[model samples]
Target: MDSQMNAPWSNCSIGYSCVKLFPPPMHTVPHSGEAQHRTSPGVEGRGRMKRGVQHRSNGRSARKTRPGSESGFEVAHDFGPAAESARHFDPARRGYTWGMIRFTLLSFLLAALLLAALTGCSRMRFVVDLVPADDGLTETVVHEDDDARWRSPKVALIDVTGLIADVRRPGLLTRGVNPVAEYVESLRRAEDDSRVKAIIVRINSPGGTVTASDVVYRETVRFRERSGKPVVVLMGDVAASGGYYLACAADRIVAHPTTVTGSIGVIMQTFNFSEGMRRIGIHADAIVSGEKKAAGSPFEPMEPEHRALLQNMVNEFYDNFITTVTTNRTGLSDEQINTITDGRVVTGRQAHELGLIDEVGDLYTAFDTAKELAGLPAARLVKYHRALQHVGSAYAESPTGSSSTQLNLMQLNLDGAAMHDQPNFFYLWDPTIFSAVR
Candidate 1:
């Protein structure tokens, strides 16, 4: 008996019955208003008892207990199916339930009525696109503020805005319009129209490439000679450099009082990154066939010979520009032409005073001047634009619109990379480009 009490297990002998010991079963009494359920004799029942004991040990119960009862069973309140159904059908809630139903029914009925009305129409039409498909150029009549005749003998208003490049000015996603091509097309249209007795070339640009500017100038001169129609240039906000170069082709130049005209010179821009590369311990190993083959290369220092060569070319182009100005502006003497042709920009009033422009006035003054030049008593004003382009008034923006001349480092363009790779000659007047280095 002593061994049996001290040992881990009682010794079994002949004629002696062995019994297994086990912990007493736990019973959780159900709370008031809840049905009693049997607890399974396994891990699940133990888990529940452990949770109840944990709640009691924490000085709290899972639910409210009767006064003096220690059971931690959760109270089953009136949240069952029957209680939910009774609450849903209560008099206080009936109005809200019925209102929701009525609203649903009304919405369905209204939707059906709308569908029926649409089906009863003669045609089922849907507007998928607002822009017209036709992209052809169309003539738009621009009514002037004054009493100008609305019928032909017409004055064709052609706009030359933005960079006057022969190449297309590409956008972020669009294959943009070519200023030269658009100008030529408009000129062709005016030439073909017999009723168009005169042309008013409205210029708003700081200039562009030398070749492009010359192309527009040559075309305008040819158009005037071939069509026998007088061409009058009306300078807008800015018509400088190549803008002024093209204006030289006009029979008479009319600039507004505030217009910025005449930057009559050429510019070839390039940068040298040799010093920067050297500071960073990098060098360009370019193998060229001749000594001057890599002339004006940014990878290396520009030699004195290279500088002279570039300067000679610039002087040649400058002479051509000066000759064009003098030939067209016959009223101005050599001294007067020399004074303003030093790549300086002047206002319209100053330009007129300097004999660079014919008159200082508004669009009306240009109209009167055009009429006088064409020898017409009265003429209608018309503009050529794409079919879908809106032209509500005389000052409506052109299709090839003007862009800010400020240099933007973040702005992306399709041709930007290619344009930067090659050296370009510009007649542009944007001083903001140098700000990047500063």
Candidate 2:
């Protein structure tokens, strides 16, 4: 006879169980790993035995049997609790158990209604991907009105997509806010939020102003220092010049193999468009309170007086930027840094060779680097993309967009108007920049 099973997993040996019914694919151990020693309990008479070792059943494992076994006739129980319980049919015929059925039906409906309401009430965490300039400027408010701030705490992914400069092509479309001011505000928020464990600064630009880049770097530094949260810079296609400068503040830096980076120098470029203007027949004039007031103006031929002044200013910023980089990246030889810092962009492989980058890989590697910096066992790699669901994009917290305003250009270029007697500048002007115009 086939004995009735009582225990949850007590059918013969594990060998027999596997033969009779194998564990699901998810539960099955792979054959390639180390071999494990195991025994079955069925062969050991129902005593505590190792798995896969055979054992037999005994009195210690007695299982109860169903009654009426002699004739093999099934036994029946008097389920009709009493005459009162027999009223089930009569109540059904009458369409209810008087007021009790109505009360039960009402209770069930109420419960179902509550369950449905609860479904809608469930709060979903939609990360608002807001920066500085985005849909936030609109008069309409989505998700929550009356509160100017995001309904939830925002964690930004700073994706510097192009050459960061005072003059930039306006983005045709984006999923989130782009304004540099928004980035500042987000940094403020991230610093305040204990929930934000780490920030992934995805830098993909050729770099921009010393001041703008420094703002991001400084705020990133402050966020880490104040909150003890790590900022990991993930270099994208081209994180050079100001891009790498900002990344220097990160606890760790990762870059794609093809990522162009390590411009680790500073630069100041004025068209000296005096020649270009002369060619175009457009003469411009400027008056200043001070002699060096319009030091780097492009319209006029660069005066010897202002040329040295502007060069000195650029030199000071270059030194500051270099200092910040050296402080952030330790163990690199000064000579190696100088080699890469000659205002030359290098690939990630070359960057690793020059010790400018930590790793050579892509987004997953960046996530891993951030995880390592944050000291997390394993963080959920989630993309914080903003959703512009509403027509006017009421979901945006700041529509400032990705780049800084021309008005704020002074803050970056002047660096508080601090200058040096002698200065060396970082250069990133393409050797063939004139070819673009041609």
Worst 10-residue stretch by lDDT in candidate 2?
72-81
Global lDDT of each candidate: 0.72, 0.54
C-alpha lDDT of candidate 2 relative to the true structure: 0.54
| Candidate 1: pairs in clash | 241-263
How well is each residue in 259-354 modelled by candidate 2, as lDDT tens digits? 887766665555567887888798888978988888777678778988788877777887887787778788878798688767777889989888
User: Which parts of model 2 have CA positions greater than 4 angstroms off?
Assistant: 1-158, 163-178, 273-290, 389-438
lDDT of 1 by residue, 327-357 (tens): 8888787688778988889999999989999
Listed per model in order, the count of residue pairs whose N, CA or C atoms clash below 3 Å is 1, 29
**Local lDDT at 282 for model 1:** 97
Predicted structure 2, TM vs. truth:
0.52
